[model samples]
Target: MGEISIKTEIPGPIARALLERKEKNVPAGPFNTVKTFAAKGEGALLTDVDGNTFIDFAGAIGTLNAGHCPPNVVKALQAQIHAYLHPCFHVMMYEPYIELAETLNRLVPGSHAKKTFFLSSGAEAVENAVKIARKFTGRKGIISFERGFHGRTYMAMSLTSKVRPYKYGFGPFAPETYKWPYPDYYRSGGLDPAELDEALLSSFETFFLNEVSPDDVAAVIMEPVQGEGGFIIPSKGFVQGVKKLCEQHGILFIADEIQTGFGRTGKMFAVEHFEVVPDIMTMSKSIAAGLPLSAVTGRAEIMDSAGIGEIGGTYGGSPLGCVAAIEVIQMIQNDGLLEQALKIGEAFQACFDVLSSRFGQIGQIRSLGAMCAIEFVQDKTGKRPNQPIVQEILRNAHQRGLVIMSAGLYGNVVRLLVPLVISDSQLDEGLGVLEDVIIQCCQNQQ
Candidate 1:
């Protein structure tokens, strides 16, 4: 526990002062996992204003896969800053922007001739991808999966799945956006995984007949591994089946890789795990290592459907974000973070396998590479979501100096988005803290 030093309580003297100022100034709409303020960060560790150090498992909500302030990214950002900052891609184009675009074009799944453009956020990328899809296909409808999260922007929110926090009281959302069911095999109540996949895939044709026609749909947007939807992993057959349906219907398949991209899932992109290639992809979160950069990459012909000057922003492709992203990609490729992701997943699974056997509250522990989650239930037989226990575990874990957060539509899942670069010892320590906390919390419920 050397890396985790809880010298003072979570919101110790200094943090309490900061929190007072924050409560007075900042809006409650913006949520925070850790109640304290960050003083500094390195790799997978974050130091708070009260002099407490924590093993960060949230990874800034999947935005710091390269870890906080990676040396190469920081060095590159410093050099770019010394030279110049944003000249605004809309007015004066820069070379780093083109360079990063080329890198994504080659790296982001699909060997076909592709084109890439920049945006300031994941929502912007989704918005532009939707625009490109509509312009290319000249259709009006879009389809997203149940329990999946896109973003907070109007169109992205329309595609998102969760309510209460994300979508409650926010309507009326954009029109023509539809929801499709993504598979959750653990909760399928004894249904065979293959059967579930087949049923969901075959139901698409019936859906078209009952709802919107296939020809009227412009695109189907899906998260390769539903991140905000409780880290739900669908069968490869299901994903490929969706792609096949799109191919047959002349609708574009848009993979939203915002939280699952950049080595979060063993591979550079999660779509590779399913062996399905998307026509268009929206990427962000770890793209620039939290520099607020996103990309929309697609088939050259389709991306070009939007005439020049139709898609762009004032700070779309800032030089700093581009340089940081370039270094981030190179860092992932050269530094062996992909393999690290697999190792983290293995460690988490191994640790939780025993815990799940002992604790009936643990409904499931699942992972695809480093994107891992533990679903809490009332009991083994019922499998009713135990959201209260999840809340207790989160609070205890935070007090114990392990920074983590909860997810799932019902808010009963504890998701781990640990930075891929975390050392084995740090990972073990963090998991140990989480394990002890879960045991105590579950026992209390009993």
Candidate 2:
């Protein structure tokens, strides 16, 4: 018997009953990856209400690098609950909040004096980072990349490049926001990789001439490895080139590490892989295990540009979130999770490399640490997005007791954000399930 144990259909009797209740009470705006309700979760395994156990690869959309219900995090949360729930940071500051800020300031790439503030979600962090950048630079125009997803809030949505579910009917977006091209090497036509980078980097100068003046731009926010944009990894030269442009034009470079931070990308942060330090950073997702906490860490002067009462929220940096985050950072350091992340990536590549040779639909196999993905296409020669095959594979994987998710602008990429603390056996079992499903689905298509 492997880690998965499916005794009932997905959304079995118990889940179906709950799903009926959820449909009546819950709004349709919110999305759910799995159709079942979680009964218990530990490490990389989650049990639904119907007694079916699944190996988790989605990791709450890249929010569980420390895994679900880590012992240290649970203990810390329990201790915090005993003392107090929410004293409310504005009413009376807490020690855990200050401790987390100090720790992030020290851990983030820069050695310069830094400050950190908290928010409730990754979107909130992006919004605040933009606010601070504009205040500090005294510019209104913000630049983001094509296919990049920052968040769903008004400003974050305005900066985002996707249009379907995220920005369909929401019109009259914030002004002074612009989009720039990001290199998608897989679809770079016939251009040399170096030529592609140079062409895109050079286009910025032209953009400033035709679109918005570089002097009027407040910042260029980027994801070192785009998460929602299909785990796209930009080359080191491209990243450095963007940073150079930001420096030359007096535009702050904000690194959106919401999905790539906290050891998800082999390094502590994906920006570290490129050897570039960001002027400001937005982080959330895995910062506090599963707690709803986000942060903006940056140079002290830049972060201080926003006057008092200009930023913050009522439930921002709740005591529980702060304590959980402090413990999560400690766990990542002490538990050898960073090295484990590299090992996970190696395991995934090993499996996918073999599968790629057997399946023609596998177009690209890419990863930066365990933030891995496999792009599916109609065929090897065509290289056209195959959303139908992806849907089939996802359905089969779910039935076989594996939880995963799809990404990319065309929704044809299968992404893996497995827990860094997942056991070797669980990791193998989960991968095996996905491989079996992919093979079965591809064979059927043939």
Candidate 3:
């Protein structure tokens, strides 16, 4: 794993064949097809059909927290598969489904009376959260932050801020949903570079009052670290400021921790890094160790407002997923993986910091544990995305037998989400390869 191994030219022959076949049939805009082949993953690395092994950084979009095909998760699925496949929790009320709910209620950030229910994806959880908020608050307007990415489903996409790809051409979205400036220092006007903390929070408070009449809003949704917009971090007073605003308005505060949960940000949840707690939280991605599962955990009174049979689905809390989650949470607790994520995050920072310092193209290097990203720019002053350079690096990285992902609204940020199960040696090897590609790409930049 130390040295770069390029046995075949990137996609190789087998991968190319698969992609050519897929391109004729699959929807092109759904996802950017990179390798022309699917992954056969084990731990931190993925082997393509070409037999080229890549130090994977995708982590299956953060769903493989326990690593691809962890022995325990596999065992749990095997155990559950024989027990029963579907009893439909809404009707039969199985043990693992209810047990997983209890686990989520206990684990998610918030000391209030908690209740949990399963959903199919982050979107369903988000939509249900809004439904619960409206039912509880008896209000119409829902407030979300700019540059926030909730999900891709119809309702979730409407709540999401980016209009170009997510909302464009998909007209007539959900109504009464409002957006305010998130504490994005790079873009939003609220943050004053010259001013101190007290003054900055006041500026944001002023914007909230002027923009959205607080009473009209039912819930205020926020991502602790703005994920897709840009890896934007709040200036210390920001999230707390928003929390106070929500309290004043009697609006429920919902944290979309789908991306930030399960030790991605080096904590159980990113909200754990902040002092204030959210009224409701939605989670997916890594909760059940690669199974299709999502949950909305919130205060008992709020979630209970929805009548029975109002919030459920056919495959929301699959027995297999529940079993996987039970084991995954145990692994997190027993193996001390939360602390390990912090350690790994430090390693990520060590490498990302070096790359950012060495290259002028690296505009900003932001990381909170393993959820790390580096934004690329053509010039320091403009801070505009250098898309060509980003694409080249991704292309070459694959060629060099390393796999990484490019994200952000502008598609100029390189996020490194290597699975937490990656061994120290494998992590080191991946980092070394990334450093070389970044350094080489920057050196050749015109």
Candidate 4:
């Protein structure tokens, strides 16, 4: 990951003294608890605003799959910056934008002819995809899963499942958006795959029959590997079953790979791990390293249905962003990061296995390649979320110079996205830190 350097307390005197200045300048509500001001990041290490170095595990909220400022991305960004700043593809054609689209259209799963459109953010990409689905299908209802996170915009928030921070008091949200249950079999109330099979399929049956009848449904969107939904990998049959149902109902299946794409999971796309192929897919986050870019790639007919000028943004396909994406794809291909992710996955799982043995508090530790998560439970029997304990561990880890993040509908899952560029020594060091905190803080509280 990075060379260890501890010169001061994290958020030390420098950052602590300046945090007040920052809070006053920016709204306090925008920041999360346990905030640490960052000065700069290279690879997997972040030099904090206080001049303290931390082994970064957040990976810029899954937008740094290629690590911070990867040389390839940097070179491409620099080269693009010299050519043209902004002619706006709609105004004037640009080669990079079209090239990136062609690459994505070809790279994504699905044997059908696919097209791609660039956007500035995942939320925008999602919104645009929904617009296209509705425009093409003439359907008003959309189906998502509980605990799913789409985005923060109006439509995005409405599609998202959380309420406390994302949707509370933000409603009434967009109408015609419906939510179904995800087959989170781990916490499925003893509902085995067979039972989940009956439950989920029945839920869909009920929805199509009554609530927002199937005919009115435009799309059924999901994260093949639920990102914010606790890194929950659906049971083997769940995704396939769901996709079959969507096909049965003539619904457009959309996979939201915003957090799972760009090789965050073992494969280039999480959907590749599953057999079901989504008709449309939304990608962002790691696709262009840290750049603000997102894409909607789908079957030619569905995507092209929304006529020209029907959907587009000023910075939809910025040449600079496209340049970065092209290089990222190339690096992933040349460097074989996919194989590296497998090694990282094995190491990470080994770390969790040790933790699981030491403490029953670790109710679940599931991962897909590099995207790993550990669910903290109060008791082995109940599998109840122990958020308070998890928070304590996180705080302790931060004090010890490890930056991490949380996930799950219950917010009790400590998820890790150690940049694929992280070194073996760095991974061991970070794992050691987490192990120490997990034992000293999380288990002790129990």
Candidate 5:
């Protein structure tokens, strides 16, 4: 079956009309990647209202690792709808909620006695994790990495590093949040990787002396792979060092796996790759196949710090989301999605590695499993970010039936989060469109 079927000029007629309606009603704050509205989504493909099908490389911003509307997830949701909708965990307990909690407790990267709780969004999970960390350690300060992004809520935003889009006017954020440098070997300015790591690690001690006392810090939250901060990946040594620093102090280590969890990195959790078990972990994005579910899994004792009524929400761990998440975990485990992620990463590297040599703008091609990105620069020597090239490439790719997105602090990175369920042929086709668009755009600049 043909994967990409572009019948109209992107928005076409029907989509343009809908776009008019959206522009009138929907506020500009909520961003849209694809100009056209989705009529249907299946596997890794999305069909627009105008009947244009796009090979989705964005995967709903890493929320569909099991693919769009996966059969198992949909089946589970259908069955759940018949049973009941919400019987919120707070009002009346549901079996699926307990089942999901048990599943996450068993699966998340820790052998210790762990507890899990649910929320409606990634921000909520992060907020609750911070609360738990503070309650458990009785500390006021929380630390996150420089390029890391947690969420948009107050506490998460305070921890988040990106200031422009996420935290521009939203001032007077949650207090006692600090930022530390995460290693970016690609941008280390000719310094050795180990040297850069040591410098960054050493800065933490300096930070404790000058900025805030380590004893006052409750937790150091990190995205195993920085998602919104351009899919930046840190070394295992760096991650271990941060964990050790947290241990040196009384601070807990919180692995923010919102974008890197559930077999996205060829592992159940990204912390597995680092060989570090976090005291607390925040998870969302792909948890329930776009069911708007997030979770905070942690050491049982730490989680128990908050009394019964202090935690949880009205819509936390809804029955449908829980059932869907259980199915998602099963699908990733049983359906070879972890290996599939590896295959996608290998294919992406093979396709982009050659381009990196051909074009001076291609600064680096990076991936940890299917989470891949190509950082563009003006030249190899200076490595000035070439954001225009990325914008052009994205524009051209969208016009040609490929849905891709950009990332990075400078917005010069083309990040690919293709669904693991994408067929080899569909993957090849999407890559072809992207490759052609890149060549055309880069060649034009050259």
Candidate 6:
């Protein structure tokens, strides 16, 4: 009766055949949330090969803010394919690339003279942003926060904070990258938010003395809302404080809005929430409505620091990606997705708040607009991460036709990256499935 329709087991006959084929052909390195291939997707609904319909709450790991295969995006891609797929921007130089650059320059915060360049993925953007920062500032060191998830390239990996899955066995990372403490207020061991902010901000001076000098630091790359770090939202003061430190020390503040940009956080970009403009911003996940496009937008002077042919790839800013991104920007602006994001966040918070009251294991419910997450703990007092419970909940939700994913270092946080365009009924139905699963799982645990 609801949006979910489970006609067969999760990995049905067709899916099982494909999975066996996938195992033979594909490497095991790539991770998958649900063990099924998608046949079709629209808005917030995805149907697998098994004929099971799921309410998509993961949104392709937050890449489908405009929802899967948006008609406008598909139409744009179709037209672009007929005209030309990739003229190779370096060789021919396309109009779509220039147009997308102009649009991002106008939209991505700050009224200053700005420029934008595109890449194929968020990691590529991060690598280039670091290169630009180093070139512009004439510095070698970069500082990233604890539990941050930058891309997996050598330079981006060095800047990333996670070790087990992202960094382990792939060491000999790029040098001069350092990690700083990012505030996790929920797990702050009774420290006041203001006190924690002040401590971390002040510790920068000590860090400069102890580890690396501030003058040698090229930039401090940060996620406006730490995506892989459990959707951790830093206080406005904390963000401003870091920016102030960057300005004082002549270090660029690079905002990694890859997961928080394009109406995901109710704002055009998550940096807008803090009212602090970043020197450079890396955006990707939801930027192109699922096209493999990422962008680095910043002040013209800083962006121009890289010499001709210094920072670019063969497929960087492909014509298809450029056109898709252009349409995506238009959709975000004109389709009421921004307002819809706020509504989704409100709905998620209301649902989670009720569940939290009933379940003490719900440690923290946090969001910046639709970028919402519910952290599960062992108990109310101890606040130990409950990874087992999260795993059970996700498994149960999947069986019942809700697609969700777990985040956080301990994998105890259930993150909701539901599409902004999801209908009210679909949203409720998805939440209902999640709620029922959580109740059942918790009761069983007890």
**What lDDT does each candidate get?**
0.94, 0.95, 0.81, 0.87, 0.92, 0.93
Instruction: Summarize candidate 1's per-residue lDDT along 175-276 as a digit string, tens digits.
Output: 999999999999887899999999899898899999999999999999999988899999899999999999999999999999999999999999999999
Q: Alpha carbon lDDT of residue 94, candidate 2?
A: 95
What tens digits encode model 4's per-residue C-alpha lDDT throughout 400-442?
8888888888889999988888888888899889889888975
Error of 6 at 8 (Å): 0.6
Candidate 1: where are CA atoms >4 Å away?
none
C-alpha lDDT of residue 30 in model 3? 76
Q: Candidate 4 — which pairs collide?
A: 1-423
Alpha-carbon runs more than 4 Å astray in model 4: none
Residue range 1-446, candidate 2, lDDT tens digits = 79899989987999999999999999999998888999999999999989999999999999999999999999999999999999889899999999999999999889899999999999999999999999998999999999999999999999888898999999999999999999999899978778999999999999999999998999999999998999999999999999999999999999999999999988899999999999999999999999999999999999999998899999999999999999999989999999999999999999999999898899999999999999999888878999889888888899899999999999999999999999999999999999999999889988
Q: Could you tell me every candidate's TM-score relative to the true structure? A: 0.99, 0.99, 0.95, 0.97, 0.99, 0.99
lDDT of 3 by residue, 1-446 (tens): 26445678867898788888888998878776257465577788787787777777778777777788889989889988888898888778899988999888888877778999998788888999998999998888887877899988877887899887889998898888777766545543444733544565576567557766667788988888877776677754678877887898798999998888888877888888977788999898889888888999999998899997888899999898889988888888888778778877798788778777767798888777788788899977677788889899898887877878887888888877778888888888888888888899999995
Which candidate's lDDT is highest? 2
lDDT value for model 5: 0.92
TM-score of 3: 0.95
Clashing pairs in 2: none
Instruction: Arrange candidates by lDDT, descending.
Output: 2, 1, 6, 5, 4, 3
User: For every model in order, what is the number of clashing pairs?
Assistant: 0, 0, 0, 1, 0, 0
Candidate 2: global Cα-lDDT?
0.95
